[model samples]
Target: MRLEQWSRIMGKLAIDDEVLEEVAAAARSRGVSSESLAQELLLEGLRGHKSKESLRQLMEAIAAMTSRDVEQTDSVELLREDRDR
Candidate 1:
């Protein structure tokens, strides 16, 4: 942990009263400040969102790499001709 991490920056956050109460209760239960708990939750949400975005990009790249164009062909005639040989 860094010394700057423990220092609070000057900013105001607007939160609903009910949500604030819930956060306060959770912080009390965990023996940490409500601000710290809120910060941790926000960080977790950001990480999860980034992971989902990375997975989506990877899937799109894989699809593009494996995609191919197909040409029309006479399947029944080709099979019959092959069987006769």
Candidate 2:
């Protein structure tokens, strides 16, 4: 799942002509081949997906913690008390 752990695995993707044109233009602007640009975009997208999954997991954890019967305190007051401690 990490870029450093990635190996050269040949795969084919069918991109729409319009999208390919956009990718080609982007690649030309960056002075790289379309294939490289596509790979970079795919990696970036995968990283973003991983980040989103992490955030979702964190939210679920926060939800579980808050679902307890403990009384909720004012966050600002709690921070102030902690800071003064």
Give the number of the best model, judged by lDDT: 2
TM-score of each: 0.50, 0.50
Clashes per prediction? 0, 0
* Model 1: per-residue Cα lDDT over 1-85, one tens digit each: 1223334452556666788788879999999987788899988988767577889998899878753685546799899999999
Q: Give residue 27's lDDT in candidate 2 (0 to 100).
A: 91
Q: Taking the tens digit of each residue's C-alpha lDDT, what string does model 2 give over 1-85? A: 2222223343445566788789889999999977788789989998767577889998999889775788889899999999999
- In candidate 2, which residue pairs clash? none
lDDT of each: 0.74, 0.75
What's model 2's overall lDDT? 0.75
Clashing pairs in 1: none
